[model samples]
Target: MSELSRWEDLFREGNLKELSLGAMKVTREHFGNSVFLRGLLEYSNYCSCNCFYCGIRRDNGRVERYRLDDDMIYAAVDSGFIRGLRTFVLQGGEDPEFGTDRMCRVVREIKRRTGDAAAVTLSCGILSRESYAALKDAGADRYLLRFETADTELHSYLRDGVSLERRLKALEDLRSLGFQTGSGFMVGLPGEDDELILRNIRLARKLELDMIGIGPFIPHPATPLRDAPQVPLEKTLLATALLRLFCPRAHIPATTAAGSLEPDGREKMLSCGANVLMPNISPVEVKPHYLLYPGKICLDEDGLHCIGCLGGRVAAVGRKLSFDRADGLICKRRDRVEAGT
Candidate 1:
């Protein structure tokens, strides 16, 4: 069968290998062998909401928690820079302590340190428009706020007090401010329907986001959804393939959550249409401590395993990580000579 036909067969038959190979081919076509890597620095474990699938819900007192200090963040960023990571993602939960002013200061310092050597992407959960603007002003180039699910009633069921309208608005808000916006969804949440997946992609395309991140629902033991079954790998790949067909050229990451659930999930996702990766650069001391979902993979493993040692994984499937500068941000940096950017 042809490439497009093969992808359709995999989805219809739910075949992992066929789907993965086709998706990988698509990924290679767009990204070549180059795997764009981002340093995922989990700045804080504290959060305000109670997502039924997260281990770090505010009520989870049993979960060990810690927040990275400004000095610590600087140190981590320095380490990542040396490792040739030009994309740094400051990811954290929604803690009141990390207010707009505080986060802007953090973003400013990161930008100063980056010095054209990196892009700062923020995944610090939901925030007010003022907070979002403050961070954007501080040289933060991207914002990754996963919507979890697109269905309104189901969205509210999974995430308290959050709605589809609010999340979609946040995405629009980020785009209007000239930030590379990212929206995400789970493959299978309770009460989720395949139509929602189509709708989610439709909305993502409508937003013209720079990135769209997604992961299968992985239940965490201290939460209400602990007993929930894992989303099958087939479903995840199918969604990924459709994303490739839909988005064509948008950046789609093969998330660690995929790797956490299935040993070879990254390779599978790569085959399906993933082009970006977020390597965990958090201090190993606290890396194992931060658990949004328990049994998250590559946390305790050395960073080499997550990126470098994965050479075998990529090569096994006819793809390789690229070590060149990346392209694609909603707002292109205007030439200083022309627009005085």
Candidate 2:
């Protein structure tokens, strides 16, 4: 169990209670009681690529696509500020209509308005170095583009035109620009094996990234892999804990998809190794509109309405949810200050 040569060793070789306890202890040692809040705003749902696992694919007829304009994007940021959102995650499909210029303007405007009140993290799909530089110059503090997988062939089959090489290049580009880069995977992906999962973890650690966004594989009804099996909730929990043990300092999230699979999923993930939680701040009416996968958690409420519920929900797990380090990326060790006493 201690060796961790295989991922299953995290579960098969020992009792889950102790594993959970170990994860919590590490979580405390690294993050203490603080949890970061990242205001997630899906600005657009118009995707160029037809991923088999997403509902926003260009080929999905049932999905009603929409793109929020600059004003609407600004309004979403303002809304998060009112509700105590200190970090803003501007995520959306790789819609060309927004363009690089438009995207930069939106980012710069947000940074101008928010000042140091929050950090702007970009999850807009892949792009050229020029585009990345432009966004970085516009003052994006972090970037999150889930690698999805380290296997090139499997990733290509799922997402058209998104090569594993390009994904890594993007991560590299972000790092070169001095931005905190985050990459992730979808556990239980079709045709994925244990080796790939282990490799993905190894790659994330090797990349020396600032954040990791591992989540379960949830299928979309309109996508090609509609009938695909969803990732097991327990497996997701184990991954979270394993991530803690592997990279104790990395920013890890108990993904919402995990919570969607089960009531205690987020709590279990936090107890295992998760240090961050991204509550949906998108509008309630449009929540179902930005469907990346089926049965997505936190879809019923907007950012304003969900804070109270999420605060209570985190309390159930014997944790606290706040805007401080809710995204779990930025580093500020508190132990040093207390040691001075």
Count of clashing residue pairs in every prediction: 6, 5
Best-matching candidate per TM-score: 2
Provide the global lDDT of candidate 2 against the true structure.
Answer: 0.78
lDDT of 2 at 102: 91
- Residue 19 miss distance in model 1 (angstroms): 5.5
- In candidate 2, what are the lDDT values of residues 1-341, reduced to their tens digit? 34555444655454566667777787788788656667789888998888878889989989888877788888888988877788888899989997889989998999888875688899987888889899888888789988888888988778876688888888888777767778888888888766677777777777876789988888887888888887677766766776676777888877888887887787778777787778777767778899888887767777678778777867877788767734333323322343673
- Give the winner by lDDT: 2
After superposition, the stretches of candidate 2 with alpha carbons farther than 4 Å from their true spots are 1-8, 11-15, 325-341
- TM-score (all chains, Cα) for each model: 0.89, 0.91
**Candidate 1 residue-wise lDDT, 57-146, digit = tens:** 888889788988989998988877877778888888888888888888988888788786688898877777887888888888889988
* Residue 175 error, candidate 1, Å: 0.4
Worst 10-residue lDDT window for candidate 2 reads 327-336
Off-target runs (Cα >4 Å) in candidate 1 are: 1-26, 329-341
